[model samples]
Target chain A: MELGPHILLALLESAVSTAVLALTAIGLALVFGIMRVVNVAHGEFFMLGAVLAWWITDQLTAFSPAVGFAVALVLSPLLVGAIAYASDRIVINRVDYDPERTIVATVGLLYIFQQISLMTFGPDARPVEPPFNTRLAIPWLEITEQGWAVYWPWGLSITSYKLAVIAISIVLLIGVWLVLSKTRYGLIMRATQQDKDIAQAFGIRIERVYGLVFAAGGALAAMGAVLIVPIQQAHYLMGGDPLLLSFIVVILGGLGSLSGTLVAAAIIGLSNGMIAVFFSPTLAKILATLLVALVLIWRPAGLFTRSSR
Target chain B: MLELSGIAAAYGRVKVLHDVSLSVCEGEVVCVLGRNGAGKTSTMKAIMGLLPLSAGQITVDGTRLDTLPVDHVAKHRVAYTPQGRRLFPELTVRENLEIGLMARGEDSRVLDWVLELFPRLEERMNQLAHTLSGGEQQMAAIGRALCINPRFLLLDEPTEGLQPSIVALIQEVVSTLSKSGVGVLLVEQRIDAVLSIADKVAFIENGYSREVVPAATLKTDRSLLEKYVGV
Candidate 1:
C-alpha cells in the first residue's frame, strides 16, 4: 500500500473514533459539569439507547430502512431521556443530589438498567441495518501511474454509512453548542451549573434543572448509541467501551468544559482508531488508560480550562 | 411590610439566633448591627428561609412566610443578598444580574434597569463577576437584588469591607431604595455608616437580639452604640 492510502486510512479511523467518542463523552461531561453528579449509569443509558434503537428499528423495518433508522434515531434518545428524568426525580433527588450519595444511587441505577436490558433484550447481541450502505472506492496517486492520473486504490475504501455517523455527530454536537449558547434554557443551565444555591435562591428551580440536565446528558449518550448500533451490534454490555472511552476523554478534556471534552475526544478517538488499526485494539485501550492517568496527575482541571480572567 | 416575631434558629442543637424579632416597613431602613458571630447573619438567613426556624413566624403583607422555602419567600416580594456578595463568580455581570430578575419572570429590560441603577456595572457588563472590584461586586449584588423590584430587600453586610466613597454609594442606594417604598433590612458591622440612613437599629449580642432603638436617639445616646457595637 502506498503512503497516501495508508495515511488516509489512518485519518479515516481517527475520524470514526473521534465522532463516536465525542458523542458519548459530551453527555458524561455535561452531567458531571453541571450537577456535579458522576453518572455511573451513563453507560447504561448508552446501552439502553442502542438496545432500544435496535428494537425500534426492528419494528419499523417493515417500512423502508431509511424510515426505520430515522424513527429509531428520534425515539431512542427521547426514551432514554425520559427514563433518566424519572430516575433523577425518584432516586437522585431523594439523595438530595449529594456527591457521594448520588454516585451510589447512580451505581444502583447502572445495575438496574443493565439488568432490565438483559431481561427484556434477552441477552442477545443484535444489529440494526444501516439506512444506506454504499462503498466509496478511495483514490490515491501511485508513483508508476501515467502522468499522475487519479487511480482507485486496490483496497482503500469507506462506507457511506460511516460517513453519515461522522456527519450526524457534527450536527448533534453543534446543536448542543447552539442550545447551550443561544437559548434561554442554556443560560439557565449555565447559571445553575455556576452556583446551584444562588440559582435556587434566584428561583431557577434547580431541582427541575438538574432533572432536565441529567436527562439531556443521558439522551446525548443514547443518541450516540443509536448512530453506532448499526456498525456495532446492540448488546446488554455494549456500552462498556463507549463509557470507558467517554470517561477517558472527559477526564482528559477537563471534567466540565465542553470544548475540552471535544478536543480530548478527538485526541482519544484518533489515537484509539489509529492504534487499533496498526496494532491490537487491547493495546489502544491500555494506551488510553495510561494517557488518562497521566492527564489526571498533570492538569486535573483539564487541557482546555480557560484561565480565570 | 415584613415582620419576624420570636424567631429562633439553630444549627444542630446550637442555637444561633434566640428570640429575634424585627420589622421593616416601606420607606424604612432597619439595620441589624452586631460583631462577627453575633447571630446577625443567622437572623438574616432565618428570615430568608435558608435555615429552619425552631420557633416563631415571619409575615409579609399580612401573609405568613416562615414556613416557605427561600425561593418561595423571594417570590413573596422578599429578595436577599447573602454576605460575600455571592455573585456567580464565573458568569458575566449581565448574566449575574439576569439571575436575580429570573425569579420575578422579568425580561432583559430589567438588565437595563439594573445597569442604570449601577452605572459602573454598564462599564464592565461583559466582565466576569470574579474580576469585578469589591465595590463593583457589592454594587452588582445590590443591583441584582434590586432588579427583582421586591417590596422588601434583605442585605447582609453590603458595606462590610469598602472605602468611604463606595460606602457612601451604598448608603445612597439604600436610602433611595427606602425612599422608593422598598423596605430595607440591612445587616451592618459599622453602626456609624448605617446610622444616617437607618430608621431603626437592632443590636445583637452573642446569640441574643438586644434592644431596638431609633437611629436618631443613638446619635446623642452613643452609650448604646459604644457598648453593644464596639466603635
Candidate 2:
C-alpha cells in the first residue's frame, strides 16, 4: 500500500481509539474532579462491561446478534453502575473519601473485580460478535495521464460498525457535556467540585452526589468497553492497559478537565495508532510513557490547567 | 429567634469555642465582636453545624440546629456566609446564587430579590465568582446567602478586606435585611462598622463570650471595645 493509504488507515484506527478512550477517560475525570478521589478500579469497570457484554450475548444466542448487542449495551452499564454505587457507599464513603485511603480502597476493589471476573468468566479471552460489520472499499485520489481520478485502493477500507461506534461515542459525549453544563445537577456537581464544605453549607447533599458521580463514572467506562468489545476481546486482564492509558490521559489533559481529557485522548490515541502502524506497539507504549514523563516534568499541573492548582 | 446557648465546640482535641452564648431576634442585628483567634468564626461555624458542638445547643425558631447534619442546617431557613466569601470560584455569580436558592428549594423569583438587593451583582452575574472584585465578591457572597431567603443569616467578616464604600454598603444591607425581619448574626472586627448597624453587640474573647450589651451602650463607651476587642 502507498504511504497515503497507510496513513489514512492509521488515522481511521486512531479515531476509533480516540472515541472509546474519551468515553472512558471522561468518567475518570468526573470522579476525580468532583469527588477528589482516585478511582484505581475504573478500568475494572470497563472490563466488567466487556465481560458482561460477552455473557449477555451468549445467553441470548437464540436472538439475532443485533438484538443481543442492543440488550447488552443497555444492561451492562446499568449493572456496572449499580456495582460502582454499592462500592462507593460501602467502602468509599466509609473511608470519608480521604485521598490516600480511597486510592488504597479502589486498588483493593481493582483486585477484587479482577479476581471475580477471572473466577466467573474464566481466564480465556472471549469475543462478542459485532451487531453489524460491513466493509466498504476506500477510494484514493491519483493523477492519471488524463486528469485526477479516484480509484479503489487495495486493503483500504473501514467497517460500518467502527463508524457507528464513532457516531455513538460522539452523541454520548455531547450528552455528557449537556448534563454537566445545562442541568441543575451539573451546577451542584461543579459547586461541590469547587468547594465541598461550601457546597455542603449551601445544602448540597455531597455524599449522595459522590455516590451518583462514582456510579456515572463507572457506567461511562463500561459504555466505552462495550463499544470496543467487538474489536477487542474481553479478557480478565484487559483492564490494566486502559487504566494506564486513562491515568496518563487524565494527567496530561489536566486532572478533572473533561475537555482536556478529550483533547489528550485524541493526541495520545492518534500517536499510539500512528506509531503502532509504522513502528511497534511496545514502542508506542514506551513513547507515550515518555511523553507523560516529559509533560509532568515541564507542566506538572497539566497542559490545559489554567493555574497551578 | 436564632439562639446559641453555651455552645462549646472543639477542633479535634483543641477547644475553640467555650461558653459562647448569643441570640438574634427577628428584625435584630446582633454582632459578635472579637479579636483574631477569638472564635468568632468558630461560633458561626458552630451555629451552621460546620463544627461539632461538644456541649450546648443551637436552635432556630425552637428547632434544634446542632442535632442536624451540616447540610441539613441550611434547610432550616438559615444561611451562612463564612469568612473569605467562600464562593464557588469557578462558577458564575448566577450559579453561586442559584446554589443558595437550591438549598431552600426556592424558585428563580427569589433570585430577583437578591439581584435587586445587590444590583451591582446583576451586571456581573455572568462572570466567575473568583474574577469579581473584592467588593463584588462580597456582594455575591451576601447575595448568595440571601438567595435562600433565610429567616436568619450568619455572616463571618463580610466586611473584611473590603473598602470603606463596600463596607458601608454591607452595613446598609444588614440593616435592610434586619428591617425585613431577618435575624442577622454578624461576626466583625471593625467595632465602628458593627456599632453602626448592630442592635446588640456580643464580645468574644479567648473562645468565650465576654459580654453582651446594647449597641448604643457600646457606642457611648469605647472602653468596652478597648477592653474586649483591644481596638
Candidate 3:
C-alpha cells in the first residue's frame, strides 16, 4: 500500500472509531452535566449491550443473520436502559447523588455488572455477525502521463457494515441534538442541569428526570456497543477501554458540552487511529494521556468550556 | 388566602426562623420586611417547601402546604422567585419562562401576559439569561414565576439589586397582579418600594415576625421600621 492509501485507510478507520466514541462519550457527558454524577460504570453498560447483543443474536440463529442483528439492535439498548433506570432508583438515588459517594457506588456497580456478565455470558469472546457486509474498493485520483487518472488501489477499501455504522451514528447524533434543543422535555432537562433548586421550584420532578437521564445515558452507550459489536467481539472485560477512552474524551472535550464531546472525540479518535497505524497503539495511548495532563494543567475546564463555569 | 402561622424552620441543627407568621388574602400584597439574616428568606423557603418547617403550619385556602413536597407546592398554583434571581443561566429568557409553564403542563398562552408585564424581557427573549443585565435577569426570574399562573406568588428580594426604573416596573407589575386577584408574599429590604405596593407590612427581627401593620400605619409611624428593620 502506498502512503496515500494508507493514510486514507487510517482516516476511514478513525471515522468509524470517532462515531462510536462520540455516542458513548455523549452519554457520560449528559449524566455528568445534568445529575452531577460521575457514572463510573458507564463502560459496563457498553459491555452489557455487547454481551446482550451476542446473546440475542445467538438465541435467534434459527433466523437469518440480518434478522437477528436487527432484533439485537433494538432490544439491547432498551434492556440496558431498564437496568440503568433500576440502578439509578435503587442505588444512585438512595445515595442522594452525593458526588463522592456516587463515584464509589458506581464503581461497585461496575464490578457487579462485570461479575454478572461473567456468570451468564461466560469468559468467551463472542462475535455477532454483521447484518450486511461487503468490501467496496475505493479509487484514488493520480496524476499520470495522461493527466488525471482514477485507479482502484489495492487494499484501499471499506466494509459496508463500517460505513453503515458511521451513517447511523450521524443520524442518531442529530436526533439527540434535536431532542435537546427543540423539545419541551429538553428545556426541563436543561433547567434541571443549570439549577436543581430552581427547577424543583418550577415543579420539575428532578428525581424522575435524574432516573430518565441515567437511563438515557446507558441507552446511548448500549446503542454504541450494539453498532460496534460486529467489529469487536463481546467479552466481560471489553468495557475497560471504552470507559477510559470516554473519560478522556469527556474531560478533554469539556464537561457537559455536547459539541465539545464531538470535537474531542474526533481529535482523539483520529490521532489514536493514525498513531496506532503509523507507530504503536501503546504510543498512541501514552500521547493521549499526556494530552489530557496538559489540558488539566492549562485548561482544567476542558478545551471548549468558558472559564466562568 | 395564603397563610403562614407560627412557622418555625431550621438549617441543619441551627434554627433560622422562629414563630414567623403572616397572611395574604386574594387581591392583596403582603410584604415581609426584615434586616439581613432576620429569617425573611427562610420564611419564603418554608412556604415553598424548600425548607422543612420544624413546627407550625402553612396553608393556602385551607390546603395544608407544609406537608407537600417542594415540587408539589408549585403544582398547587404556588410559584416562587428566590433570592439572587435564580434563572437557568445557560437557557434563553424564553426557555426560563417556558419551564414555569411546563411545570403546570400549561401552554405558552400565559407567556404573553408575562411578556406584557416585562416588555424589556420580550426584547431579550432569545438572549441567554446569564448574558442579560441584572434588571433583565430579575425581570426574567419574575416572568418565569408568572408563567405558572400562580394563585399565590412568593418573591424573595425581587428588586434587591435592580435599578430604580426596574424596581418601579416591578412594583407596577405586583400591583397589577394583585388587582387580578393573585396573592403576593413579597420579601423585601427596600421599605419605600415595599410600602408603595404592599397593602400590609410584616416586620421581622431576630428570627421572629415582630408585627403586622397596615402600610398606611408605617407611613405615619416610622418607629417600627427603625425598631425592627433599623432602616
Can you list each candidate's DockQ?
A: 0.64, 0.89, 0.87
lDDT by residue (tens digit), candidate 3, B166-213: 888989999999999999999988888888889999988878888999
- The regions of model 3 sitting more than 4 angstroms off are none
Query: Which regions of candidate 1 fall more than 4 Å away from where they truly are?
Result: A141-150, A306-309, B12-14, B107-109
Question: Which pairs clash in model 2?
Answer: none
lDDT head-to-head 1 vs 3, winner: 3
Ranking of all candidate structures by their TM-score, best first:
2, 3, 1
lDDT of each: 0.87, 0.93, 0.93
Pairs with steric clashes in candidate 1: A254-A302
Q: After aligning candidate 1 to the native by TM-score, how far in Å is the CA of B151 from where it should be?
A: 1.0
Residue A230's lDDT within candidate 2 is: 95
Candidate 2: deviation at residue A179, Å? 0.3
lDDT tens per residue, model 2, B29-90: 99998888899999998888889999999998889999998899889889999899999998
Q: What is the interface RMSD of each candidate, in Å?
A: 1.4, 0.7, 0.8
